[model samples]
Target: MKTLDFIKLDEKSVAPVVESLKQLLADFQVYYTNLRGFHWNIKGHGFFILHEKFESMYNDAAEKVDEIAERILQLGGAPDNRFSEYLKIAKVKEVDSIACSDEAMSNIMQTISLLIEEERAVLDKASEAGDEVTVAMMSDFLVEQEKLVWMLVAFQSGKCHK
Candidate 1:
């Protein structure tokens, strides 16, 4: 087996971003589960619409989670996936409480907003450290999260209401 040496980050330089990435992964996992919950439990005039949107968002979140975890592993760090560790590190809160359409939209917006901030922070650190790979990953995530935020905002604004 051959290992690639594509990354130029030293362990010391990568430490903060790796820690931040771990936190982001944990937050995203919780957000993903919450999206699933909203998808399953959402009820209102826009039930089908919200359900489908939640599913799409959750699916994208799941992929991002995988990507983050894999990046951590590539950096020779462990990917924190345990719920206990997630609870400790995640900035996003888990929502087990059922919510109405407006409440669910609010929750989704809040989660996406937090993610946007976290992703931007990671991108900034990556850029400062000249870590192109991390910056690229963060950029991709930023686009996805921005789209999710826009959709949730539109829904909350009744622009997407049908």
Candidate 2:
């Protein structure tokens, strides 16, 4: 007998989607850690502004971590919860504490670029698997992250200044 999740997605089709989601979960965890470090340690001219922004970002990341883990469980897969597992599978590495706001922003841009790539892959995989829920979630993430990436690039390039 073929096993199906509550949503009627078969385990066979859901397996690949779940795997991709797990990888995303791991990446989000690492990114969250880096953002927390940036929030606590950021300095220089934009210290207050950057610190607040990092806090907002990490808070959003924390919510995303929960959503990804829950989605894995909804698909009948165990979410990889260990830091060790995350470290092994995550492409986004743990960054050392960054005190420089510019450097931290640069790192954030790089991390977002990597995330956009990974999320697109997952979006494709989920679409292929007929997992509409995951597909929708990834699409939403991509839109938001894409905007953030655009804004960061503009800020970094001094294009944001009049």
Candidate 3:
């Protein structure tokens, strides 16, 4: 039987979707690791805020990682769990260290922008395939990420959200 036969989606139609999601999963893995490192190594002014923010972002990323992996399984694809694969496939490059608050937030914004682009591509594929579940997931991700971009911009401008 075709891999997606049970789900009623043409495997051919969903194949690219699955591949795109696997790439997204790899990106999220790298993003999660980078956030963790930023949280630990953030220094200088606004350290408290950036540190807390990085921790929160990384925590969110961890949840997203799981969600992406589960989605891949739901779509009849194996979730690639190897970091080596992530390094090879992810567009979001890993940072060695971000010592400045501004630079760290900038890095985050750049990464989020990349993710937004990726999620939009996934959204389009899922929409074309009539995969409402994946479409909704991508929609939700886009909403949250767009808001994050705005908020991060404000934060970088030295404006506190509260």
Candidate 4:
């Protein structure tokens, strides 16, 4: 018997999907932490702009963290809430506190890019198993993240004029 049985989504097919989602969840947790560090330590001329951006990003990340965890639960798997587990499983490595505006933006771009890759993996797995729910979730995530990549790239390109 699975928690998702009522929804017609068996736990068997979702096992692999749940595993992938766990990895994505862990990556998100680490990314969220890095965003917090950026928000707290960003300095210099772009401090005001970057600081607010980082806060908004982390706030969004926090919501995503909850969504991922809830998704895991819906798939009949336990959400790994432990930071220790996140550190062990996440490929998104933690960064030291960043004060430089350029460094902060660079980290955001890099980490979010990696996140896009992971989201695609999850989407692929969900699609494979005919899991429309998870597929839609991952699709939504990918679309939003891709747009974020575009905006960040635009921001980085504008730095050339300086």
Better-scoring candidate (TM-score), 1 or 3: 3
State the lDDT at 33 in candidate 1. Answer: 88
Backbone clash pairs for candidate 3 read none
The C-alpha lDDT values of all candidates are 0.82, 0.89, 0.88, 0.89
lDDT of 1 by residue, 1-162 (tens): 212245656766777788888988999999988989988898878888888878888888899999999988876678976888898878888887565988888887888889889989988877776778889999988886777677667666765445
**TM-score-sorted candidate list, best first:** 4, 2, 3, 1
For each candidate in turn, give its C-alpha RMSD to the true structure in angstroms: 2.7, 2.0, 2.3, 1.9
lDDT of 2 by residue, 1-162 (tens): 323544788788788889999999999999999999999998888788788889999999999999999989888889988999999999999999799978899889899999989899989988888989899999999888988888777767775455
Clashing residue pairs in candidate 1 are none
lDDT of 4: 0.89
Judged by whole-model lDDT over C-alpha atoms, candidate 3 comes out at 0.88
TM-scores for all candidates: the values are 0.90, 0.93, 0.93, 0.94
TM-score of 4: 0.94
Provide the global lDDT of candidate 2 against the true structure.
0.89
The TM-score between candidate 2 and the true structure equals: 0.93
* Winner of 1 and 3 under lDDT: 3
Candidate 3 on 21-41: residue-level lDDT in tens?
A: 998999999999999989998
| Count of clashing residue pairs in every prediction | 0, 0, 0, 0
